[model samples]
Target: MEQHYQLLRKHIEEICVLTDEEWDVVAQRFTYKSLKKHQFLIQKDQLVPCEYWIIKGLTKAYAIDSNGKEHILQFAMEQYWTSDFNAFQNKVPATIIIDCIEDSEFFCLKWEDREYLCHEIPKLNHFFRIKSHYGYIALQQRILSLLTETAEERYNNLIKKMPKLIQRVPKKLLAAYLGVTRETLSRF
Candidate 1:
């Protein structure tokens, strides 16, 4: 647990330095948890009150359409912070589902703690703001790829960006994420 906390500290310190006292205060607010593959972190229609920073393993955020097809919005891996952002920020019910793709460990921070820390520690605000910006940029790139790129093109780009994903994530999930069928993905 102490080692995992150090990992979180290192992730934050990359954005801004935290004093020992400040780090202590920040660390105390988070609760650590572990989840098995197939466990749901945020289920659709449930209230998602916390955000999580992945310490190990992988997860996916997706929405199921009326036809019961899953459309993956994003993948969260080690060092990434993920949650139903709309639900966490607005205190609303989740529209997307987040589930573990592999056995995972995370540091969870409740909304109250996050709000308080953002105000109590200005550097923490800087850290979160930077992460948010990068998240937005990634979203934009994903949208552009979905709008214009062929599924094969998207698959190639995804492989280039995350070669290990093909090995780690199930092909069906990867196919859904790439807007291709599993058979189509196999051809690539």
Candidate 2:
């Protein structure tokens, strides 16, 4: 538990420095949570209360279509921050689901708590803003890849970008994320 907080502190420091007192305030606001393999973190139509910072383990954020096919948006692993951002920010019911791919631990920060922390700590606000910008850039790149690149090209790019993720996630889920069939993914 202490190590998890330390990890979060380190992750934040990568973007901006935090004083011990500021760190203490930030740490106290985050609540720890654990989930077993295959457990739901956010279910569609439910209210999403917090954004999670992964301490350990992997999860998938996805949606199920009317035909019951899954469309994976992204995977989250150690040091990643994830949530149904639309729902969390808008205070609306979630449209997507998040589920643990492995036994996972996270530090959860509620919207109000996050707001308070950002207000109290200017560096924290900068940290979060920088993180958001990175997230947006990643999203844009993903969109461009999907629109312009072939499946094989996308696969190669993903391998280069996050080889560890390729090893940790199942092939089937990878296929879903790449918008390819499992059989097609196997060829890459």
In model 2, what is the error at residue 23, expressed in angstroms? Answer: 0.9
* Residue-level lDDT tens digits of model 1 in 1-188: 99999999999999999999999999999999999999999999999889999999899999999999889999989999999999999999999999999999999999999888999998899999999999999999999999999999999999899888788989999999999889998998
Each candidate: RMSD: 0.9, 0.7
Off by over 4 Å in 2: none
Model 1 TM-score (2 dp): 0.97
Full-model lDDT for every candidate = 0.94, 0.94
How does residue 32 of candidate 2 score in lDDT?
98
TM-score on alpha carbons, each prediction: 0.97, 0.98
Shift in Å, residue 75, candidate 2: 0.6
